[model samples]
Target: MAYQCDLGNNQTVYLDNSGSQTIVTTASGSPGQQQQSSNSFETGAWTAPPEMYRTPGGVTLKIQAQGGDRWIQIQGQSSNLSDASSIPLQEVSQVPGSSQQPMQPMQPMQPMQPMQPMQPMQPMQPMKMGNMEMNNNPMEMRMGNMEMRMGSSPQNTGSQRRFCSQCGSPVQPSDRFCGNCGHKLS
Candidate 1:
């Protein structure tokens, strides 16, 4: 058997005991904007009086047996004690053929498929910078108009070289001043 009560502001609460478990459902909002939440308890859980039930959405229900009759009081987060007592809870039975169907048990989840292995990365190719090409060979390097060979040093075809005392830069032997820093060379 199911008993329903209407709360103000388009909200209705239903207590259903037709199945093995007892379910308390709260439905609110208008036709297209209706929102519902249900909380289930063991069938004999409500046999004792002054039982408190709290929904997942924070709605509190106080059920008590008074004068051989059951009474339910709903208290939402925003509702004050005075407002909760003002709303009368009347029990209404479900129509003969319009009772709600019991909820079905959830099915077991399927196992996930195995993932494919990743492909190996390809080897890196030679890189080219502005007018310069760099390869895996470390003995050779080429830039703009210059080429350097790592294995051998170039032979100097000029006379003995002189260095600037102030900047330590190599200067021409015949130069009177350092070409790099303009320092006078003896």
Candidate 2:
């Protein structure tokens, strides 16, 4: 069966109900001048085109029903619509096997508090030294009261040679006297 309605400005809407699907079509002015659009909605798990109808003012209205998911959506399009006009009159989504609750309008949010000022940082004092000596080789560092040094362990040059303390002369390891000054090297 089909139902028909006149929409003032020479426009007519036709709704055809047959089988498990319903189709809605609109025609305006003369048959040849009609900017015709049609949509169909079905009752089963099968997919169908969304239902759309346009007013005489060129504003299009669309509706979609998902029979398997149990959700319905409605939207409108207009040339005068603003970019920020996004809040739908009604919206719904369903999660399979979960309970669903109706939606409520959101409340106005409270303003945030101002941030606190930061405290100034204290300056650090430089380290004091009585007498400090620094060397590049092995990097030796000495403070007046303390010493910090880094180097490898002392190594043996060769046979243990000795020096005569009285005349400052080189002495062999087994020498009993300085060979040049004859100083007794006990």
Candidate 3:
């Protein structure tokens, strides 16, 4: 025997519309004015870096607002943001134990892939010493007694010191060595 259905049967399916809210805004904060964490991104100074990733339409991020500190966890098997501050790279389905997530935007699945380790920046050039030939800058070069003059008078680094080349008694600036006795006193 076949059962007969009533023609007046009315069904009103209730669909949950939760994705309408995407942008989360905290109370208008006074930026760095409010005192909380010593180094909490400077409040208003807290900005996403250049290399940041964004979640997809169906995926959602969970944020826990602690006492001024926001603790976040990457939850969502298939949805993974590589850089939420710099480069936005969407992780592929290679995440481990990534099962079919719910198509609801309001419900975000737990992240399957672990956070990627941060890489160090590379140096521009190799570290190596150059020549020792001092330049005109007296600040870099140091003499035994004679201190190079800057813009005005030539001041001696040490007082009661002979010239670079002492001859017999006092070596003159013009004479490289002493006329009577040649002596290197530089």
lDDT of each: 0.58, 0.50, 0.31
Worst 10 residues of 1 by lDDT: 64-73
**Best candidate, TM-score:** 1
Ranking by TM-score: 1, 2, 3
Give the C-alpha miss distance for residue 178 in model 1, angstroms.
Answer: 25
What lDDT is reached at residue 53 by model 1?
A: 39
Instruction: Give the TM-score of each candidate.
Output: 0.38, 0.25, 0.14
lDDT of 2 by residue, 48-147 (tens): 4333334333433333334442222222334433332322221123222223444677999999899888886553433435576665455556554344
Which residues of candidate 3, in runs, are more than 4 Å off?
A: 1-93, 96-148, 153-162, 165-170, 174-176, 179-186
Candidate rank order under lDDT: 1, 2, 3
Worst 10 residues of 3 by lDDT: 8-17
Better of 1 and 2 by lDDT: 1
